[model samples]
Target: MPKMKSVFVCRSCGFESPKWNGRCPNCGEWNTFEEVDALPKSSSSAGKSSARVARSITPLKEVDLSEASEVRYHTGMEELDRVLGGGLVKGSLVLLGGEPGIGKSTLLLQICEHLGKEHTILYVSGEESARQIRLRAERLGVVGDGLYILAESDAQAIADTVSSNKPDIVIIDSIQTMGISEINSAPGSITQVRECTNLFMRLAKSEEIPFFIVGHVNKDGAIAGPKVMEHIVDAVLYFEGDRNLSYRILRAAKNRFGSTNEIGVFDMKDNGLEQVENPSQMLLSGRPTGVSGCCVLCTMEGTRPILAEVQALVTKSGQTSPRRVTTGFDFNRVWMILAVLEKRLGFCYSALDVYVNIIGGLKIQEPAADLPVAMALYSSLTDKPLGDDVIAFGELGLGGEIRSVSHVEQRIAEARRLGFKKCIVPRHAIKSTQKFAGIEVIGVSSLRQAFEAVK
Candidate 1:
């Protein structure tokens, strides 16, 4: 028997230390170190020996330079496929991280069901049983003979199963839940996560197997694992949205093979995760007519443009220092916009409690949303509603000047498709577009011009 050692690990960043400390030096997080038993060297050595025997390496120049036809396995969900840059590529490792109950498992199972026909998919769940997965599959109406489920957490066993079955794709329900028998650290610990991820990475690269791993989000909403987990994977995707809403947005934060900024839209249904074909249309549904505090904005999510509603409400505050509350939009940004309105437009909202919300549970992070947010606030303050057919989007400067936004053409096209008859855009955008059919484009250089045109 080999001797067992112990180490201290940071919970926040997965930084490891040989001894305990009050502060984590790597991440600067206080009191995050937790002690865990370390794996015996002999056990890890045995695994390494197996890996070396299983894998063969060749020189870069010695490899054939033939141009092999690219193969894509569709996940049966168009939205997911689009986000993955068409479909899953061979020998790729994708990491999907999100909060609990964010439908990570559901989405992957749905993908398996969709791809089970043409591809042999191995669905390994460390946290759930085969019967539990079958029940969910039944609920999703996805009964396929090609989809195989294994409820196991040991990494060695999983590796053996993958080698024997030769699956086209493999999905680990979660990497954190997987415990390597060779590693003495508990499952979800830093050492275990690092070891398991390394194994999966080697498997994907050596076997030319495309694999997906479901990751959990920490309290700070970041992927819960060692930083190396992200570095080891080919792509890192985040599934984010309010649990209260039916819609969820999947965005690629890091991609080695494709664009990182791409996004995919999905709606959580009772049956399973359903891809939202036209997100703009679904977001604009149930929009109130003739609302004073409402304005339309076109915001870009990755390469796609989505038209969303921005709503603001201003009322007298009973407390000292009027409260500023914002949903889906940054609160500090709202304050900055209010200050700009007071200085440039001569509107004082200091005595009012302002509340802002981006409709449809969509978060607006782009500065282009500033124009519509300001318009909505102004409309509420003055009790005047803008035309229902009007759509506005542009970045607002502190001096009241309108700033140009990226991908203006896509925004305009989305507005046109959604039947928005009038558009208020930056002056710079107007110079670029010669003409757009069936829509009136109003270009403004400053906030005053925008207010006048809408009024």
Candidate 2:
């Protein structure tokens, strides 16, 4: 037997040292070093040799393209399928990272349940036992023979199971919890995460099998582990949303086979994750009948248009400096609008505390939401309510001018579908032959013109 040595490793950047220090020299993060025992050189060598033997590589151009049609597998979830560019392609490795209890496991389990009827799926969980997973499946009302579960964390054992089963799809509950015996570091450590991800990548490519690995997010909302882990995967999807809200968003940050701008929306339910086909209806529900601080806005997510409610509150401030707060909307952008309101509209908002919020917990990132945000603030200050049948959205400039927004046609169509009788948009957005039967489109180039038309 060889003697084991101890070393200190930094959790942030995976920097290793023989002695501990107060600050990590590599990542500059304090109190992130931990001691771990090092494995013998012989064991490490054996593991590397085994991995190479299990996986094979070939030139991309030399490989036959005749079997391309058989490489794709449909998971039966339309939203998910869209995000994945139609379906899962064989020999592709996908990484799904999110905050705790963000439904990473639930979404993957649902996919397995739906695809298990036609194809075999092996689900490996390093953090939970078979009985625990069974209970969860029962609660989710999932039952299928083609879906198999394994509750082990050993990398070698998992590889062996994959080789024997040769299933159509494999899902690892999380990659951080799995450990390689050849690595001296504990599970969830940088060394272990890197090695396990490499092994999975090898298995996916060599076996020509599609694999999904769930990942944990750090306190800063970033994917846990070294940055290299993200580079190794073919696709990286971020599952994000406020835990207090039932809605969750799955966005593709990186994709080798599809567009990165695509997103999928799901509502958390007692049974499982339910796809939200018409998100506009849910977002516009429970809107106040006649509110001074409310406005409707059409925003584009990817290629789809959604109608969302914008709310604002303005009141005289007692403090020396008025406070400005915003949720689900940009803070700096709100400040910019305040400046415009004070200068262009001749409004005295400097003495008032302003707050803004987007209804249904949806975050607005596009400039198309700018007009509604400004109108909501103005309506609150003036105590004037906007009409229920009117919808407004456009970008605001420093000169108090309205700018054209992308996908204007889709926005108008969505508003028309929701029974909105009037729409205030940029002049450049209106087409020549574009006319709705019952709805009217008002085009404006300046903020003053928009306010006069809406009033």
Candidate 3:
């Protein structure tokens, strides 16, 4: 018999070290090393696997793809479908991650009502018991004859049951609580998560069963597991928004079968998650009128155009150093914008405090927001409100020039649909040559010209 040895692994990057350290030498994350015992493999199960082994290689053109014609299972939610490219692909393993109490389980269970209509579903929960799942389903009015629930944590046992039963779809309430007995480390460890995900991935591909697994996030809002676990899955979806707030944004970080840029909006209710079809209207619901430091920004999310309000506040500083606070916007980007305003436009911001926010909790990552951000800062500094029916979308360069943005025609159509009278865009974006009847398109080449035209 061989003596077992314990090794320390970095939870962030899955880097194995003989000893523990405060900071991971691989990923540079502090206090993330965890002790894991290395158990010897059983000799009796040597070279045995439930996964199908390929007997021979075939040409790519010779492979049959007729079965893939109708391989998608729609969850009956348009917003979710849009984010997933079209629908859930067969033999695909999707990882859904979110903060605790952020409706991760609720969204999975809510989709079963529609999927159960034509497919058999096997839902496995490691956190909650069968009775608790039943209680939640009853409250949500999710009654399906083909829905099956299991309250087990053993990954090997669940895999065996799923292989024998071979349900159409499977849902793991969470991957953290699941563990195989072969590993000596406790459940949710780095080793367990990686190995368990491998097992599920193999099972899904070999059996052609789609899997939806819930994952818990860490304090940094990243999925709480080895980074390899995320790379192993076919798709990775993250839930973003405040839990106290009603609206939740579902964004995909990785998707082998779909576009990663797509997003789905949902309104969390007492029953379950209700899809927000027209997110533009939902975001502009409680907009204030005749207010300085406020501007409308039209940003593109995948194929959809969303209107987000950019708000800024410029006030006199009382402390030795001026404060620059921002929410739902990048802190460093805000500083760069302020610097451009001071350098290019000759605005004195050395003794003034600046604050910026995006309404409805939507974070704007696109450069098209630059024009609106600069406009909001100018409005706040001058204490003058622009026209309520005005909107803008153009990237601002370091030289204070308005840069052309993609999808100018789509942005103009959305602004016109929203009843905006004037649309400020980059001069180069005017090359689209598509004239909108109702909306006035104002093209500007420089920052000074944009402000002058707006005034």
The CA-based lDDT of model 2 is what?
Answer: 0.84
TM-score result, candidate 2? 0.86
Q: What is the lDDT of residue 360 in candidate 3?
A: 89
Instruction: Estimate the TM-score for candidate 3.
Output: 0.91
Candidate 1 Cα misplacement greater than 4 A, ranges? 1-32, 35-70, 218-228
Q: Whole-model lDDT, candidate 3?
A: 0.87
> By the TM-score metric, which is better: model 1 or model 3?
3
* Greater-lDDT candidate between 1 and 3: 3
Tens-place lDDT per residue, model 2, 1-455, is 55668787666555779999778798787777766555345333435555444566899997787866447788878888778877888889999888779999999888877799889999999989989888888878789568999998998799889999899889998898899896766788766776788788888888988999998876541234434367778998889898998999888878898888778899999999999998898889889978898999999888889899999999999989998989999999999988987888898898899999999888889988889898899889988997888899999998888999888878888999999998999987787577767689998888888888778
The best candidate in terms of TM-score: 3
Score residue 416 of candidate 2 by CA lDDT. 93
lDDT of 1 at 48: 58
* Per-model TM values vs. the true structure: 0.88, 0.86, 0.91
How much lDDT does each candidate structure score?
0.86, 0.84, 0.87
Q: What is the lDDT for 194 in model 1?
A: 67
Residue range 1-455, candidate 3, lDDT tens digits: 56668788777666789999999899788888887665335321223663587777899998777856549999878888888879899889999888778888998898889999999999999999999999999988899668999999999999999999999999997898999997776778776787788889888988999999888876651334625478788999988888778999999989999899999999999998899988888888888999999999999998889998999999999989999999888898888888889999999888999999999899988999999999999999999997789899898888899999999989999989988999999999886576779999999988888898779
Candidate 3 lDDT trough over 10 residues, lowest sum = 38-47
